[model samples]
Target: MLNDRYDNPLTTRSQSARDAYVEGVDSILSANGDGIGLLQGAVQADDSFALAHAALARALQISARGAEAVAAITKARALAAGISGRERGHINMLGHLIDGDGALAYAAALDHLAAFPRDALIAQPLTGVFGLIGFSGLSGREAEQLAFLAQLAPHYGEDWWFGTQFAFAQIEVGQADRALQTIECALERNPCSAHGAHVRAHIHYERGETEAGLAYLGEWRRDYQRRGVLYCHISWHVALWMLERGDAAAAWRIIDDCVRPGKVWGPPLNVLTDTASFLHRAELMGGAPQPERWREVSEFARQLFPKPGIAFADVHAALAHAMSGETDALAKLIAEPVGPAGEVVAALAQVFAAFARQDWTESIALLAPVMATHERIGGSRAQRDLLEFSLVAALLKAGRPDDARLTLISRRPKKVGARAVAGL
Candidate 1:
């Protein structure tokens, strides 16, 4: 009865199994290399290790390998009967999540966290922007995320994995100054911390440190393997900064190389959302609409996200559909939005369609009403900036430069310089 790195008791007695499981958990928590493979090794070392199968299931689910994830979780559930209480709870939580029962999964995660606050794997799904809580479609989720991390802070003192996540929570809650300090110290402790690097990049974006962000991420991206969980999204950040710096070719190159539909080796969720967000953001900055690229992403959305439950991905899928002239698909998304933020998703779907048609007034009319509740769509402020800039673009296109100016000043005064609309 050895323990995990977090001191959670393991049911398996194999040292090799325990070691690989720990490494795999570290990989997942840090957004680094080969967690699934490591967990597979752990399972191979001890097939009875219920947590290894559960970890593999969760990793596969996060990587968008749905069928494999289901298989793994099923195995984990079959083995859960003999494991510790903490292990059984962990397996069940991930099972609910992988099976698309998010409400149950979320409730189970909170309950598990209350009993085992140091179970970073259980808490991982509730931490980041795309986590259960972050994408819960609940308003004030950002504040909730911060509070969730804050309460667990004392349990994970000086742990780089927890620090990176906690600092990101701070950044999302508009505490960038403090997040900067936290992430900097975290990164200093683990220089190649992918989660830390991503959080640091967000702080840079928050403070409008365009050139510095581009340079730092440019260097950081070189060593970060493509297999890393955060690779595509992190590359999205680099491309975005390059686009903002007027290095359009470099930006497009990154999109083509690492962030596009056919090219990206990351999660399908990341592929759909990042490509659609970057392409439209690039278009607002006067970049020509690449119909072929739009078609690729729209097709990607069609095949992968046939029915969108995640509100953030749904809106981007709608954008890709609208931009690619997949009117039937776009119309379907607008008519049948899903999840807690379905109302906001529906409106934004129409907004994207209107914007695609150059119906600026319609876009604005549809978009403005959802502005107050857009947080329910679930993404970090940096990722959701696509919507903010879209409104600015719509206002400019509708011969409402003054309104656009006021909107920028009133809502995102600090990001005015980063708004991409030509007239603005």
Candidate 2:
């Protein structure tokens, strides 16, 4: 038996397998390339390595390779019988998450963390504002995320990766100064870390420090490898700040160069959401890109048309269909019932559809009641602001200038250059 970097026991009997698994985990925490090849390579070196199988499954799930994820995890579970309890916990946690059972995943992760506090893999699902618990209907999610990290802080003393994770959690829960301090420590430790850059971008986004965010990301992102997982997302953040500063051209350039048809960062769903959401808002700013661009996005989105599982993806899918004038497809999507969060998704779908048709009154009506619950869609506040932007745009277009003003003021601390993006 061997232990991972976190001192969690592994069932692997091969030293080569252990080395590959450790490298894969490190790559994952660094938000670098998929690391799937390394994880799979570990299992190839030792087919009975349950942890490697589980890790590969988790990576597959993240990339939206659902069939492969299921097969991999099934193999992991079959081989996990003789593993240590903590290693078994990894298989269980990945199982729950891949099945979309977020609550069960969070519980398994928490239980695993209690016994292996430094297991970054297990800690990951419990630490972020958008982690398993964050998506599990937990209240005070950001606070809860911070509290969980606080407990594990001692276990990860001076770990640069942990520092970046901690900083982002702080930023999410309104501890801007602390986030800055923590992120500075992380960057000092590893300036090329995509995790550090991602957190630093979020910190700047929170404080409305648009210029600083742009400068920081511009300098750092130039050296960022295209293979990094955060490549598209970090570029998305850059586009956001550029939009804030009324530089739509620069923002679109980021979208075209980094996030679109060229690269593979993570899941297609993530890229689709960022591209479609950005374009939806860009159009509102009177800077509509080429119609062919919307058609390209719409075509990609159409492949997952009727089975939009996640609310966040569903809304963006709606944006794609609506913008492409695929009214029939959009109608069908609205009619289909998703799960508990379906109402919010359906309402948002209608909101975008209405906005596309210039039916401002309909857009306002559909978006207003569901506005408060937008967080349930499972994205960062910056991402969820797309909904608010849509509503405000509707309010103004509908001749309700006063309501639009109120909505704008309500978004406290304000979004960098969002007013310019919305033409407010």
Candidate 3:
């Protein structure tokens, strides 16, 4: 068995393969696209490298190559028969994740970490995909995520990546001061950490610090590679902040330059959904997005529909189709089975559809029940704000000024003026 940079066991006998595998893990921790190639190199260097294959499966899974991820993990499982306990745990963790059993994967990761605390591969599942820190099905995931990270501090003392992940969980749980300090420490260790930068963005967004958020991303993104996993999503943050600043044109410019359909990097599903959401939100604000843009997103959504178990993606797809005037496509997407997590997304879709028809009362009714449950769909507090915006807008349009005023007063930041209510 070979060991990773943190001295975690890897089921690879070849030294070159081990090095490539470690590099791949590091790339993933940094959110670099190079991780995919590095992990592929590891497997190429040694076909029997079970741990490398497992890690590669995770990378492929995040990249939306679901079939390839299944193949890679299947190969990993076959080779795992002879690996050490730690390596087997890694394989098990990734295998469960590939199988879409997030709870099982998370359980395996917890067990793996208890035995081998330095295994960052095991830790990845608790952040990126069905992460406890981000979009997780577990109730009170934030508190559990923070407690878990705190418990692991002794195992990963002063590690930059751990700090970044911990800081993100901190931000989610309303520990902003600690999150800021932790992320700053992480950035001090490696300024190029895209994950740290992302956490910082979340910190700003959650606090409603729009200008600080913009300046931070503008400076940090100057050095961030567009090919990385987070560039488009981070750019989406910038666009959102620009909208918050009342610079609708600036928001559209960022979308056109970095996040628009056919122009952005990262997963097609993620980029197109974010682009479509931005366009729809802009239109709601009375800022005109080019109709062709909506059509482009509609085309992308059509390609991804009928595979709608992920609620976040489904909600965005519905937005794309509805905005583009593809009523038939929208209805078909709504009718697809999205599971319980998708329930709120489906309701939000109905809200949008009703709002489009100027049926404000129906829109308000559809939106009211889903507002609290929207978080169950696993987007950031920032991403889920789109749903809140819809609710407020529908309330106003329904002539429920008292209700809209109460919503804005309770939910929106005190800094924002009447423009948010004035349709941009």
Candidate 4:
């Protein structure tokens, strides 16, 4: 007999249903399995309840049931048709979860707001989706998204989610100083926002404050664990930091504990495979014990390279060959033509191979054009950093000290770490 109090029905039963929906939302946030079951029951009883569907979709996404999450979001959108105010805003938020392309999701949210002018729920998804888009390496798209969100920031003052996203975008465009300022503002407004903390940790990492970055990540991990959710992206960043510091064993342990078991929403398997490949290369550089996991990851990469949507797999495979001293394998990978981004990665992989072989001249030759066109190279800052470091190292090893010094001077102001110094 329960019905939503806000619905057409005007009775105690409707009031009870409204209370149930509220309880369901709270339960899902608290990671209660029974709460999700109750939400399903409530949605079955009232197919027009948009909140219940959106909440259910969020839970499903957290559980890694992407297809089910999409279905739930579809239902929520249908139920929210012609609705305005918070209900429509919630629908837009759920739309972000279902849309794979970040730009498309932002557009859809903007369309929803064109109808509902004073919607508060729009801020949460807009910020989160924009942050993820920035990570996907489209700086232009990220700037546009941030500008759109900034227009609403005045009306939505102290929005921690939006502030964190703005910080993340700043980091993407090599503006670490601005990113640090924005993240500090976010933490001042909401110290409990994990995304804000994660951004702050990266800023610290970029500044070569490795210990501070590790501490920040520790706090973020503990906070998410207490909330019964895991932020896999932060964990991945921690792993990378550890690898950079020549602690491959510690990096491997972090990935094994948090990422490999699928306990969290980590990167796709292929991406993790690439991380493992890099860790193996780090181990070789640091004289650490060879990890058996590297071979397993290599096999995974080999299987993944032939599949579409796994363009980065080629780079990982090439790195694996370079690390293992398999010149023939490396040559084959580098010789194969690829897209613009892929071509850059392939050229950079050749630099790694040449460096490993101590062929400094060939390494410099391979990397010069890539470095000259670095601005036009389409990939994340992380990928570009790898290529830039290789080029600087090759220039130094080839005895072009002046060119190496100039490259270091030009880039070191923007980036940090020994890789930028290239032994100068």
Residue lDDT tens for model 1, 276-300? 9999999998998899989999998
What TM-scores do the predictions have? Answer: 0.97, 0.89, 0.90, 0.68
Count of backbone collisions within predicted model 2: 1
Candidate 3: the clashing residue pairs are: none
Tens-digit per-residue lDDT, 25-77, candidate 2: 87777767547899988999999998898888877776668999999999999
- Which stretches in model 3 have alpha-carbon errors above 4 Å? 128-139, 289-291, 333-337, 414-424
lDDT of 2: 0.78
Show model 4 residue runs off by greater than 4 Å: 1-47, 58-64, 77-82, 85-106, 113-132, 135-142, 174-178, 226-230, 242-249, 260-265, 269-292, 301-306, 310-384, 396-405, 414-424
Candidate models: Cα lDDT each:
0.89, 0.78, 0.78, 0.58
Cα lDDT tens digits for candidate 4, 222-321: 6564223335556766776676666667877877766653444443542444365445434433434343554555555555454323234455566656
The model with the greatest TM-score is 1
Clashes of each: 0, 1, 0, 1
Pull out the clashing pairs in model 2: 244-417
RMSD (Å) of each candidate, 1 decimal: 1.3, 2.7, 2.6, 6.1
Candidate 1 at 37: error in angstroms? Answer: 1.5
